[model samples]
Target: MKKIGIFLCLIFLWSNINASAITYPKITSQGAVLMDINNGKILFQKNGHGRYAPASTTKVMTALLALEKCKLDDNVIVGKNPPLEDGSKIFLTKGEVLTVDQLLYALLLHSANDAALALAEHISGSKEEFAHLMNERANQLGCKDTNFLNPNGLYESKHYTSAYDLAQIASNAMKSSKFREIVSTLSFDIAPTNNHPEIRHLHNENKLLYSQKYKYPNADGIKTGYTIKAKHTYIGSATRNGKTLVVVLLSGVKGYYKDA
Candidate 1:
């Protein structure tokens, strides 16, 4: 009897140890991934490869391409189409002149659709052509399930990316020093443009960077997105003790910031 009791206790302890080793956060998001930036290891994931609308988070790729293709100080003349795009914007008007730097600030920090369109047009002469570039870049990055129909990430039937794919794109973007600096910024001021006289103050939308309630200790940034269909999508990064981590959450019905 004594030997049997000791064996049962040992089995219970081993089970508990195994359970603890496998424990992970309970998240409401339909798709999520936590990746170690240094090694590209997936620490945890739920439906990481499931395709879903990316919403504004698509700007991460847009920002990445802009950094690769243009200089920060390069002048961009806003065209008629960028201003005409609906949804969040810096209210860019046709013929407005702004630097690529200024447009990037608006794109990442303010989630401005117009800014994304402007950058796209500047880079590829049209958003449609820019999307081809986006897909090509995604393929280069080893994104197996991503299709970008627009630079602004506005809803489209085929515009979708998986959590794992987004993490891969974000990881590549984070490698650039300029991209790192831009996404990590908490706020920025875009001086009066040729078309708009008022100074535009852009605030970072990633709560993990600023909100007291939601802020993560070393949170830097990436992007956020939402539409009626896409729900809440976010790509967040943080560095702690010299190790950087990236998290992607998609189709989150509850608060994604808190989940991150």
Candidate 2:
């Protein structure tokens, strides 16, 4: 009986130690998910299927459709409406010509609202039509809780996505070699164009890729977003030891990167 009691105590202690070892940090974001990119396994989540405004993370869908429908070298002539877009921009003016490749770099690296509008207009003839395409693609990807009202992720009452849905969209976008290359780039230059004479140097806004304070090991391609309504949102990807993970956070108050 004494030996049996000692064995039972040892077993209980071992179980306690293992339970303590497997704990996960408290995630503060309202919506969050960590997924294995390769297998679509959801490793962790907090309200992963809860809907929230996605902000500029909508560009992942925009960029993916652009790559699918247009050639990189195809030229897109800026329209009157793109320059009129609200929020961040490269200030593309009417009749300014840039290839699909250049616009993608602007769209992803800089999160340029104007660039997203231009690509949408170029690919689908108008933002409304392009939004239709965005929804269609999201549906096909098995995302049941996403709706995109604009390619640029500007605030709209109905435009929203869950953390899981956004992760699915981002994982699909990362499959493209060009998409991967463009998002991973730290900075790029759009040479002097008909609309502007001086070279426009654009830097990536994703702090995880460049900012020392927020940088994560093995971090690479992905996107970030914010709006008064959305607050803060991010989709971050990193790879280590042959496995890649995609982390999504939406509607966080601040410091979402640290939570990631």
Candidate 3:
């Protein structure tokens, strides 16, 4: 009887432990993925490999290419007026000049379409040529499901990526100290340029970085996006107890922070 009681107690403890273990939460995003960057392990996923519009998250690859191709201090001249687009912007005028580093800050913090276009043109001579570099680098990074139609991620039929592919791209991007620094920035102030007299104050669009109610501790980085077709997209990374985790959410519901 004593031995049988001990065995029963052991079974109960085992059951309780299993019940208390961490479990994946149900997310409203059409596609999502959580990855452990330290060891390349996928923690959780929902339609992670399905192709979907990535929105402005495309800038991750754009920024990566800019970093690789241009020195941080290299001057990028906006020789021609940036293409007219109907989303977030820095309002750059023709002939405006800013360093590659400064433009990267604007690009990542504000999701500036103009900055994206300027960088693309400066680095590769035209948007078409820059997109080729983005694709080449993405392919090298093992992103089999990603294709870039433009630098700013303005919606295009051919512009699509999978959550799994983006996770890979983001994982590689985070390896750069400069990329991490730009994404982690909460707010930045850009001094007036020759073309614009007023100083530009840029704020990060990712609410997970600042919202007191939805704040995730140690949450840094990534990007956010929304279009009529791409409901709401977010890629986020946070470090806790020495481990860094990356999450990708595509076509998510309104409560983005919780879903992220």
TM-score of each: 0.91, 0.91, 0.90
Clashing pairs for model 3 are: none
Q: Judged by lDDT relative to the true structure, which candidate is superior, 1 or 2?
A: 1
The reply for model 3, stretches above 4 Å from the true place, is 1-21, 81-83
Per-model clash counts, in order, read 0, 0, 0
Q: How big is the positional error of residue 108 in model 1, measured in Å on the Cα after superposition?
A: 0.2
Location of the lowest summed lDDT over 10 successive residues in candidate 3? 1-10
Off by over 4 Å in 2: 1-21
Locate the minimum summed-lDDT window of 10 residues in model 1. Answer: 1-10
lDDT of candidates 1 onward, in order: 0.87, 0.86, 0.82
The lDDT, on a scale of 0 to 1, for candidate 1 is 0.87
lDDT (10s digit) by residue, model 1, range 1-260: 12111112223333444423554657788898878778897877889999999999999999999999999999999999998999999999999999999999999999999999999999999999999999999999999999999999999989999999999999999999888898899899999977788999999998777777676656788898999999999998877566677889999885666577
How would you encode candidate 2's per-residue C-alpha lDDT over 137-254 as one tens digit per residue? 9999999999898999999999999999999999999899899899889999999987789898999999878777776556786999999999999898877666667888899877
Give the Cα error of residue 54 in candidate 3, in Å: 0.5
Q: Which stretches of candidate 1 lie over 4 Å from their true place?
A: 1-22
